[model samples]
Target: MQMNDQRDINAPRAEVWAALLSADVLKECVPGAQEVTGSPEEGFEATVVQKVGPVKATFKGQVSLTDMVEGESLTLSGEGKGGAAGFAKGEAKVRLEDIPDGTRLIYDVEAKVGGKLAQLGSRLIDGFAKKMADQFFENFQSVVEGPADEGSEVAEAEGTDEASKKKGWFGRLKG
Candidate 1:
């Protein structure tokens, strides 16, 4: 599958760029991310979980970033598995554009799946991926933007504190 997503963040490009580079912030931002570990030279090792249709999987993926152009763009690829549920390998090209009041972030992603996930039918897979992507962006936006204007509770369901960090779903997948 292939998808494109564009978002305008109400922050300077540099600030947003910094957040992107920070492992802690990225871990706080991505959806369904139970844990993420990395070193730039070593790439990102992440474990994620999700339930699609009736199938469920805890995917462990290693992501490598290449063709990096500082804060402007990069291409990242990785493979993730859901155990008996299936697995997927995909690549995403992410670009950032400076605007007058904020920055525009865009992702062009392509992915392929095998195992039970591929067997589930395109409609369901596409739907699930889209929803996950949307939630990720929403979480990222909030992390950068701070809490909503309504003064809502913090959305750290992904777990942020040292305690939660040690006990998070991602922590369980660390290797």
Candidate 2:
């Protein structure tokens, strides 16, 4: 499947770019992500748990960033193995544009699945993929913009300390 989307984030382009480079921020943004480790330059190792239709699996994956152009754009590619649940591979090309108030984040994504996941039908898989992408970007926006900009209780409840809460998700990550 292929998808394209954009989000207007209320932060400087540099800050958004930095957040994109941080594995900690990516872990917080990715839906169902249990763990995400490593740096953008070295690539990341991730474990995520999710249920699609009737299949529930823990996916072990490696994610790498390529075609990097500093704060402007990059490509993210990844593949995961889920034992019997199936395997998934995909890539996203992400671009950041400077806006008057903040930055415009745009992405084009393509994904494929095999084994049981592929057997679940394209409609189901497509919807799931779209939802995952949306959730990731939404969380990323909240992290970069901070709770002051978006005011999400869910963000607050996600185990941040009082100091970190006041600092904003991205700011806390910088420490």
Candidate 3:
């Protein structure tokens, strides 16, 4: 599956970058994120509960940032295993640009699932992935454009946090 997203943040490029990479912000933004272990400056380990149709599983995974070009762009890759449910791997390239209003955050993502999970079909997986991505960006926008608090403050530089909303990864995944 593939996806793309863009958000206009009211903060500066530096601030947007910081908030986007913060561990606290990511933990809050990412759907079903249980714990974020490691640094957003680099990456981290995560456990997330995901579901599709009648299938449900908790996934243990690692996410990392690679092919970085300072404030220009970066490549992030990760994989998750849901025990009996199946496994999935994905990569996304994010780019930052200065816009008339603020910083424009853009991303292109691609993902693949295997095992019994793959049998669920592509439309399901694709829809699920898009939903997850939307959730993350939505939270990011709220934080970056709203206020600057301890959690909402920028991470390495430009950043923010997704409120106290505890996300449940429950829904039929579209592929």
- Residue-level lDDT of model 1, residues 99-172, one tens digit each, is 88788989888878889998999999888777776787667766765533321224354353532322222233
- Is candidate 1 or 3 superior in TM-score? 1
> Residues 1-175, candidate 2, lDDT per residue (tens digit)?
9999999998888888988888889999999999999999899999999999999999999999999999999999999999999999999999999999989999999999999999999999999999999999999999888766344455567755543443456666556
Q: Candidates 1 and 3: which is better by lDDT?
A: 3
Q: Write down the TM-score of every candidate.
A: 0.80, 0.88, 0.79
How far residue 1's Cα lies from its native spot in candidate 3, in Å, is 0.9
Candidate closest to the true structure, highest lDDT: 2
Error of 3 at 149 (Å): 13
Spell out the clash pairs found in candidate 1. Answer: 34-170, 35-170
Clashing residue pairs in candidate 2 are none
Ranking of models by lDDT: 2, 3, 1
lDDT, model 1: 0.75
Superior by lDDT: candidate 2 or candidate 3: 2
Task: Give candidate 3's root-mean-square deviation (CA, Å).
Answer: 9.8
